[model samples]
Target: MKKQALSLLLALSLMSVPALAKENSADNFVRGKTYAGQFSDLPEGHTFYENVAALYEYGLSVGQADGTYGLTAPMTVGQAVIFAGRIRSLYRTGDPEAGPAAFTAAAIGLKDAQRVYAPYLWYLQAEGVLDKALDEQLANVATRAQMAHVLANLLPETVLPPVNDSLITQAYASRRRITDVTEYTPYYNDILKLYRCGISVGSDETGSFLPDSPITRGAAAAMLTRMVDPSLRLTPDWHLPELYSAEGAAYEDLVTAGTYIAAPETAADYDQAVRYMLSQGENTLSLKYDQDFTVSSAQEALNNALLAVKRHCEQGYNNASCSYNAAGTMILKFSSIAGDRTEEYRSETLSAAIAVHDALWQQGTITPASTQREIAWAYYQWIAANCTYDDAGDNTSVSHLPYSLFHNGKAVCDGYTGAYNLLLKLEGIDCYALPNATHIWTVATLDGETVHIDATWGDQGNTGTKQYFAMTPEQSYSLHPWPKENELPQ
Candidate 1:
């Protein structure tokens, strides 16, 4: 209905990308081996978000904050560069119409180019993205992979593939002179990060970064190979191996990280995999569905309390009433673990709580609106829910672990905080979770005001208006922003 909510809904809808006929993953990607999770500014999602949130926070692919990423949007070279400087090495700056060339991040920030770049700020100058003279004007409008391709060009021709038509267009598109290109009105933090990192240089004589245009399979292959190849990235020259055979790696010199044979073979195999996955409907597609759980390190905290309920239930196995209360309570306690960085497991736990609550509601026991607090219930459920002194999951992985309401659950404080923090983020509500007297709760900003959200009390169910607190905007601002992630930096 509202513009923001409408935008949020649209973003949420893009998460589902239909499988493009499966293929042999062996040739394309190594599950845990080939891909490097943590890159540039993003510490890997650690499987915390299946499709959206994982990439969003890391600044790779952002979500609607209402829990949506335009996952299916056919990526354009210009739009893709947003993650260029941060996720990959690359830079683009300069006058779109002068002598264009690439430059390292540091080189472009010369005293003369402080507010603007020179003609040859080449990091991401797509060869023909725009008219040479006007290219420099379109800086900062490229995408991650687009910039990567531009930088890859700096390497010897043998190591780097030819630039694509789309990238060329994107380079030109971004260079359009802004009507009010005043000094100090622009922020090139993203571009600067890439340039300084030596990931890419500026454009050719007419400095520009084409930020529009559709990429082609050939160019995509070249760019993808270079990014994955460790050798190509390590080297700063451009040299493609002599074109010898019809197949095999004609572009091997430009790639260092991959052992991939070629795109045709890989794409074909991928198609097959997609077909197989499709045959099984969407269930087998791991990307399409979430994983179920066992009593892993994740459940160790809540299972202790569930164990008691388990034992009691054994005697009166099918008693619906006992089953509902015991399981429901455990589910609430389990909520503490909602932010386990494992959404699959968290979703499972939430589903259980909802199931129990739904049954109770059907019997006219719990109020309908009361379910609003289920999100909160999941928080404390995982935290203090029957947790023994030290549980494996929280002790080893998470910190500031919260004790459940009645020793009926287990969750490290990290999980609790993450759950609350992410929930607000997913809902597009700006909020921060805080720690006080060994307990955790969140402060949210909405309608120009701050609101306190205490999951512990919220999950406990309510009498009237019980645990939810609303703070004056100023009071809420006192709560610190969410903490950043820890990365094994490069």
Candidate 2:
């Protein structure tokens, strides 16, 4: 095997401390190996031919009748199951360091049964890894994301570490292509786990996981190799900075934007610049600089700060993008709402703010003597009672915005959070919009700690209890996990 130069420190930090049963010095699992083979199509220089050959040598696969490895063919779910069994057998025979464990029966059913792959399918079913119903076309091609799900689940229980142990899910979730994965998908976390486990680093440089794309035969072999080999993948080079710190945030911007900037005259100046940009809200900002203010660093810092501030202003539905020109002028544009931030939207938002304040005040839900819990609970109940959930308007219009809740008296999660958060801020409560994998919710500081307050889930047709309101991290994480747990209060 050829030596693959990579760093593991960052990789280790991104994942949980893996408990490998024993250290195997065998190079079978290591990457960068080459082999001459009978396969006619997979040439020596083909992208993943080495992996395909490795799997073949390991007895995980047999070449086609034509002696060609279908490197670009879409892998079938049944074939994936067979691969899992072959891999388990390889570990059992070659390593000899670990003992076999019992497999639990799967809870879900499988439809079509190919006799050749039946034993492997039954093994996966007993392991509980194949716990969901499969389609009738057992030979149908599987998607790249589906492959991720199956491969991640097939990881040896002993080799697998706890999921999201490094709290990197939020960082992974920020990639531009994540929107490609539909909301509430079954394999959502499994796909993410594939990256965290060092089995895959996504499809491209932009962190485009491209989960729905079909898995190629060669790609499947490479993925299978990486799944068992801990040292085969590269560490993620980027992460979100300490959002509350100006210097940290500035550094993050510089890294992501890949732009150089002249440092501020002093650290104090940089801090002031960041704080000021955040306070500017949704306006085009112009920053004048002294003759010595080259602002090479602050330029990128300013852009990053604007992004964070925009998140706060829009309650985490951050659609605002900003950039600085050579003239030192900073422009902020919100393309998501575009013309929708018209006179109509602003007037309705303002009216909703006033209405929420008046109602809460009149009801005595928030007062100098009221506890944060009481204040938050009252607001959650108020929104639940006043607004009916608009399931169809989820992503159609501005129905998720604050104005929709007041005007239409209907909303999705975003509107429930936006309206409630605005009301809390009016009464001087510190609240923030929190991000789940594909959804958003509200969190607030109350009674010396932060608590989750999801009005959308709490509103159970006006007859439901406030069970979801004021939930602790433990209570809400399973359903609405805050990817950045440390940022939220313990």
Candidate 3:
């Protein structure tokens, strides 16, 4: 049968092309390397590797002089026609080169003599594979969508007819890469045909068919292999690595350790630093600041550190006081008892703050029924009922600490604001100490509004009334004025 097919070519006055491959003893066909160095550029494990190899083995295609298969380079109309005709010839007579002679003979009679694809174009016209009206596109690149339509028309009924649209649609939808094609996609039926015949699989596992994407020569070679033998399969598994910023790992480590560094170089580092401080436990944060850091970054980090300290107290860290510098050098005590002469006195102070917070939580002061404003008011009343105004106060007096208000039931304005902020913070209502030169007060978020609450003033004869409860910034200014009202949260 092969002899008769070869004889038919001679009868057409066709000249024989010399065999390209040479018999060699160099062991040139290495498994990981190219076949006889023909496609040296084709890397192993590529999506089209096996299929292109099969096409080369079947004598349907050859690589360029530089040994590149050009898998991603666009396939011209000439190349597409040659591939289609070669597959047809291979199927009919088991001779892959059988169609080239007929194509060459037909090219000489064409008016467009300068056309490189004229022979393949005329051959396709004679076989009724394509019409002469498409001559203008002879030099244009073949598209994936166009390939789908052409494959549907040329392949056998058994290969082309049984493409289950429903199965293809289900498969297409399951893949993550394909975004353009839907059940309602244009050229929908032809796409189903290509999928059914195994001539095309959407780009990788991502489900991107890229239907309109221009087809490449090496890709065409693989597609041709599938068309000739529908049993051949090409499934691509491509994974792109996840990208991360330079600070991502460091930030993650800080969060995992539950340790805060007050000076971090970047914004990401600053956030992780805050999160580390917030996470519950015995937090021994380094109070040292980097002298070579930006002021805005340093301030933001310091502010967060302070908030973390308050959150620490809110989370029941009464006995443990986190100490840090107030300015660049002057150290100040935050949250814990102040002016304790000995360890025995300091231990007693911690016990008092915990006892007060536990008593409120047990009383359901922060229950679902109570609003943040209502709970805050209750805290103000608690402070008044328990604590007395400490008039004869020194700057380092224990009366200035939250510990004094809870432990001794005697406090200055600092102690009133500190104790009030601590209790309100414990309930998760945002509260902070607002300070002036001589006095301190509390600013809290209540009923979704930032307001001022002066528990000291509310302590009229230690009565603890609603007269000073939940006052707006403007309202509080009338009785007690502060210069930096615009600096607070709106």
Candidate 4:
């Protein structure tokens, strides 16, 4: 399937050759050592990795000789502008290699449009990635900050928003390695957080997040090494030659611990990293069961399970351009890709999962359940009051979990339902984990008919900690709509 997609993309690229004004390269992206890797001229130190690979496979970025990327080459303002424009094009019409046809034609100001590289001005303007810049000095030149803003616009709101103001303006600007605000806001934020943790460093100028200059590949890799495992500074094994540090016990430890398949330092290292992070070690939590264990033990075991689950969730998020917080709200490109799956991301999965064993012990005592509807009445109240009466005309599919939307807790739809199910399971009630077309919801059985219970709606409502659609099994979900052949696993 992967190979087939690549073939299709390559074919598309060929078909697009006539329409595209610029010559395409196969090897432009270089994976950074850190989340934000600056470009470098050197081979090992400067090749673009995953994103580049995807670009090449899709004909966005190609490769160079020696199987390396000239990532270090300075990016021009116009080039960066065009690159960003291409990303916007890919985002809107669903194909960077394809032409614009399915997109809604939005009006753009001619003055700001004139500043963009002519080749991509249309796409950028169409996607709203382009800022009018009409009243600002930047109206003439595109900066890294502007480019980052465009990416931010392309990405899910769950993804980090653009960074503004120099860190020097913040208390940490002096030692902060943050620079250039325009290109990679999330990476910048992650880098900002790390530097605040004393994991990264800074330039000689005023303490600030450059937010404009691109990062170096080597610097990026090193930062990734630090972010994933701070103990890497101490360990000795995971360290690679020349890459590993000695004398620096802290840095050396980073070499001793595990690596990431998700974060492949080298093609050869991908296997080991994946194994260590996914298949083995503490990164993957274990569930221990004792038939005779006390309720406290059970709680501890559950907490452990949750920790592992959180790690998995975080990793899954890392792989995706979208993500969910603990509340299960999702932030992603809802309208374009799969409209908001926030409905599914938050629903009753967790409730059902926990209910699997909540009755096994029947301790005859209460426990704190993490469901969105049970003890967390505050949670329910938040969602109910916050949800907008989703406009029929607004088809932009951006999604936010109930928790996030109301309480800044965000869960996707699945997360919302799963949380409701989880809480109800704790309270000893059977709720409906309903999956609708492109969405999953929950129906708590109400009095006689099943009432539609949406935890996300709960978050948007004004009620306190209670189900937004709570009732008897019949009222919440028993309406008998005659299940479709593919309606959830009901």
- Report the Cα lDDT for residue 147, model 4: 37
Q: Where in model 4 is the C-alpha error above 4 Å? A: 1-42, 45-51, 63-69, 97-116, 134-143, 158-208, 212-490
Cα lDDT tens digits for candidate 4, 1-490: 4454344223223112222333222121222223222223333333334333333333343323334434453343444444445444443344453433333133233333333344454555555645554224322443334433433343322222222222222323212223343233634544343333433444434334455566442333333233222332211111122121112121111222334433232323432443344433233322223335455544443332232222222111111233333332322211112225433432322333333223322331222222333333432443454444333312332232223232333456644554444444333344445553445556544333444565654554355334445544454344323334212222
lDDT tens digits by residue: candidate 3, 73-120: 887665676667655554444443555556666455554422335655
Number of the predicted model whose TM-score against the real structure is largest: 2
The weakest ten consecutive residues by lDDT in model 1 span 313-322
lDDT of 2 by residue, 253-337 (tens): 2111211223333433433443344344323334444334335644554544433333343332335455555554544444335
Candidate 3: clashing pairs of residues: 177-206, 177-207, 177-208, 178-206, 178-207, 178-208
Count of residue pairs whose backbone atoms collide, per candidate: 116, 5, 6, 126
Of 2 and 4, the candidate ahead on TM-score is 2
As for model 1, its CA RMSD to the true structure in angstroms is 27.4
Distance from true position, residue 328, model 3, in Å? 63
The parts of candidate 1 lying over 4 Å away from their true place are 1-344, 356-360, 363-395, 398-408, 418-440, 444-450, 456-468, 476-490
Q: What is the lDDT of residue 464 in candidate 2?
A: 32
Summarize candidate 1's per-residue lDDT along 298-323 as a digit string, tens digits: 23323322222121110111011111
For every candidate structure, what is the RMSD over all alpha carbons to the true structure, in angstroms? Answer: 27.4, 21.1, 19.2, 25.8
